[model samples]
Target: MAESTDPNPAAPVPGLPERILLGAAYYTEYQPYERLEADLDLMAAGGFGVIRVGESVWSTWEPRDGVFDLDWLQPVLDGAHARGIAVVVGTPTYAVPPWLRKTYPETTAHSATGVEIPYGMRQDVDYSHPTFRYLAERVVRKIVGRYADHPAVIGWQVDNEPGHKIFYNPQVFAGFVEHLKDTYGTVDELNRRWGLTYWSHRIADWSELWTPDGNSTPSYDLAWRRYQATLGHDLIRWQTDLVRSLVPADQFVTTCIALGQQGQDITVIGEPLDVAGANLYYATQDGLELPGAQGLEGGLASFFVPWSGPAYLSLQADTARGTRQAPFLVTETNATSIGGTADNFPAYDGQWRQTAWHMVARGARLLNYWHWHTLHYGAETYWGGILGHSLEPGRTYAELSRVANELTAATDALAGLEPVSDVGVLVGAESRWAMECMGPLAGPAHSWMGDPGSYDRILAAFYRGLFDAGLAADIVSPGQLADVGPGLPDDAAAAALVARWRVLVVPGLYIADDATLDLLRRYAEAGGHLVLTPRTGYADADAVVRSTVAPGVLRGAAGVHYLEYTNLVHPVPVTGAGWTGAGTAWADGLLVDDAEVLAGYDHPHLGQFAAVTTRVAGAGRVTTVGTVPDRELAGHLARYLARTSLPVDPWRDARPETVTVTAAVNAAGERLRFVHNWSWEPATYRLPAAVRDVLDDVALAAGELLALGPWDVRVLRETP
Candidate 1:
């Protein structure tokens, strides 16, 4: 067997490869025959440089409890190494072996209803259980000891996407109580913060506290969510530390964090890993083109695309990149329909390439398909891979090879390129948690609150607005903005991260701590622009309503105050400064203090209140939006803000349907442009100068009209 030479146990945490990494998840244990050598031939032909293995087969690794059987994986790793392919070994802890499951039944987690989840599928195990941890350590030590010196191994993916489920086990519940005790110290403090006096629910002892089941207090639910998020983070850190103790520093560790997985705090989960990764699957076309997508004529919906796949994908990819503040790896994506279903559409001719290149443009250094071949038998048997179940080279395989070759050609040009933008979208885990506790989105009782999807809809609307304005934006998390305190953080790096952005967008962040607001106030005072929407700063970090007026702690900087708001039963007409639109969902009845009214409601009773207002704070400015703006208003504000504060404007025009452009510079200061037509119809754009496409080497001149077919994307390199 080949052995690792000198990777240097102490290196400054190696980053992604210099060239783009083309890879896929390989399963040698799942093969029907002995085809390790033959599979390597296909991998080489497709230009794959890496294969992820050993993550899915825990039962195969240990046939019986404590009986290690790694004989099957050795040949696969060695064969891939012989063919010049690297390997990323998975911890295999995601799926528990039947023997271990039966021996220590407590390892399995229970749902909110207190029923223990059966062990048929994966991610049913309670990560907090001591039995699971003890056995996991044994298996991990054995695997790492054997493969730590393997030549082909480059990294380890820790327990495939922790936080897919929440553990309602007794251990977790006791841990929750301990966490609350550490935070509050006494029962009176907990009672006060959670407003237990209401409905005579006051508690005298800590034992009275229970899980947030059924209709528990909102504050209790918020704390439970936060605690669960921490649980996920701790599991990742524990596994990462275990791996590092045995392997060299160069052998990186990561887990594929899934977005919209409510139980996990992504920022904390990604903090301990060497690099960040995400599994991004786009929404199918059928889901987007449904009725009401196009909206009524002159309505708010008309302002956005019929389908918002481009913005959603961009948002997910940007979230991943911002997690580690560096280029990331797409650890899992699909070559075809991600699931086996008649409704699951196969990837269009050029769609997969477009999606892959989109990630590259957003600063992903590596891309890997979920699997090499479709499974012969399983729940995901129809999730079509690069190769079909027949294991024959087909159209999907040909497409993979083509994309692989193109990425190879453009590797030098795309490597180390950083996306540049003046806008930052503020997001927080606690904010999401608080919103979840706020209650159902739709009901006659809470008619002022919009539907269930209102939160995401508002965020996506503004994101799409940025696209329409031809400006790119970054999704900024609270962790990335923490001030320099007791830490060894590079002060220069911390300052530069926030300094790059000229504008900060806040979307209904109903829950925020004082420190978070303080950070925002300082960012605004330091000459940064602030954009605020309704329902922001209504509650503290504990999910308790602020005692002060709405937008508490931020009111001074925001320059607006509101005591009453209403959810729109129908769209309300709004107009200001030559722009016209309608407000949806909820609208704040605002009385501007030191701010100037930019927009006002045109309704009969609400005519006295402002719909939008702006305040000047030192060297900065804050604009408070009282409701969700129509598409026209969104585009108007985007262009107005771009021309006001930003020094470098990337787009020449704001024709929503024509094109959207993003610009970035590599470490070498070479500027690259990503131009996209995020629509289903044909579009065109005029080139600014003579430029060459990075992928196809096609060149065009300034003032030349370039045509783009439906869903087309072009990466152009500027000529010196």
Candidate 2:
């Protein structure tokens, strides 16, 4: 064997450097070090320690596939190391080289409808195609082998972000069908769980199977997407395994995905890594908004966003830029939109220190600047980057060095310290896929307009509503919590908190197995609060042989008959032809036997349906909201949960909006509060009892809130 090694389980692993190591991507076709070094000096001066190298190496490595060169990589690696910055080597799974694309035409992907786009696009590869996996694996293995032992290599990012495809890929359907066949051992069995008899979707032969897409769109049933999601997750799983096969167990390995747009479940992406980090770019002007516009829930969940997994990364963002962006100024996101937007965007030049300090205060350990190098040709044409379009350093270099060195100083402490938490949100990946495949207006195969239009719309509204409510929820993997206790960041604390947060809200997740649901049911029966929204606990984790109406095995817990879910009452009536209907707020109707109706929906066409129902089951109560609720409905859910749990209010002392805050308890039982000033004017915030600033070591007055400057960061702690 290469070298038998044992990563210390007791000692904290050094994944992300302390103080949020700051650095930039440095990929300029031919830029002088003086200019590059000038920026490097600025980065070092500004307090950046980690430099993301080689995201754009494909353009140089093989102008065409089959040709390889080690000439260019050495100098850059040497340069970054010489500057004392550790490098996060990114896998080039995204953006296949033209040569590779040409040489391996088979690697190209096709949409579910069988529309094939040859060349000239990112994420165009069909995930289901064996050739695509083969080529990607080949390229990744080659890269890992060459750089696995490199001194500068500190972490591994499998792809810039995989799963950018699932929506439009033909591979999703194909792979899903194959997975169901393998997992079930037969096709007839899969049909029974999906209730395929309704849409004439029953199939006797596995070869005749279709996916969850247009031509191959498998009846928009939950089982189809459940299987497809399994496929998507399997893609990440298989790829993650490939990463570990190449790298040692100690090295942190992960994939970076866009917020809200991740095609696959993010819960799985972080499974392979020691730490799970994501790109967090919260818009400074509007709360949790991005520097530039993208989608609705901009960056609210950007930092560690509530997950039941390993430690996460807050690796991307720019606090201060040369250009005035957003609440800062021009709303300039990054210098250029090279991360993947059209060019002609605003750019910035500034020191990277303040943000570094802010991240540390906010609880980010591993810090990475958006773009290290300006992409030479295609990748750089737009998007943002640390390197100027000219491909040289400007004002952010020296600052990078300074911050990285600072992180290096506190590396051991930061790496060793575990992040604290109290609340645990259950995230079931199979459930999400089931919802996706079930179409917009999903029901138990019995509802008006049970097409894709209704299902997708309802599902989106449900998730977005949860997000808009500022619930601070996250998708968690049960595998991570298997070790379930206290003083530990993983499963231990989650299990220990059974009494603390006995109540959990699962919105639209279906395939929770008995073991997983038992955790919730037992917690609730033990006087815990449980909120089971529409379509929960129906199928097993495998999602293959579901007998219950929910995703998997937890179906029998609610003790309700598997009657036809036919009621589709809209709380608000619909008129227009647009996708949004029923006020896009309250949509589904609930059902109950001896349960109580907390809420309901009454519309013109559909009869009155129970919008909410509550019943006492063991030591707990389950309130099922059988509809996709919009942002406005969150208050109702919150109000109901509040009444049921009556637990200590986490936001009891939180004010409205002048200052937004999120609080968590560390593994040491220390409280780390992420307090963000949401206003331009300085304001005071009332601190919790006895909490003080961790760094300042100042004692906070119990009922007295402290004053903060505009956009200031404060870490509160108990008085020393």
- What's the TM for model 1? 0.90
Put down candidate 1 lDDT per residue, 1-720, tens digits, no spaces: 111111112122353466777888999778777788888999898888888899888888888998998767788888888988888888888888888779888787888747799878888889888788988888888888889888888888888878888778888999999999999999999999989998788889999875656645778888899999988888899999999898976788888788757779776788888988788766444322212132212111112222344566677788787676666778888666665444345565556666777788776777888888878887777776777888997766777777778888887887667777658888777777766556323433554333434556667667766655666777767666652222534444333433656788887777788877777776777676788887777788778888898777778987889989887767787878765767766788888888988889889988888888888876788888888776667766777667666654424463446466777776576778777665567777878767888888888887677777755678888887
| lDDT by residue for model 2 (188-284), tens | 6666655567657778887766544533233335445444445455666677788778776667665555534436555555444444445554322
Candidate with the greatest lDDT versus the true structure: 1
- Full-model lDDT for every candidate: 0.74, 0.49
The residue pairs found clashing in candidate 1 are 448-567
- Candidate 1 residue spans exceeding 4 A from truth: 1-15, 32-34, 284-307, 340-343, 439-454, 483-498, 648-658, 679-682
lDDT of 2: 0.49
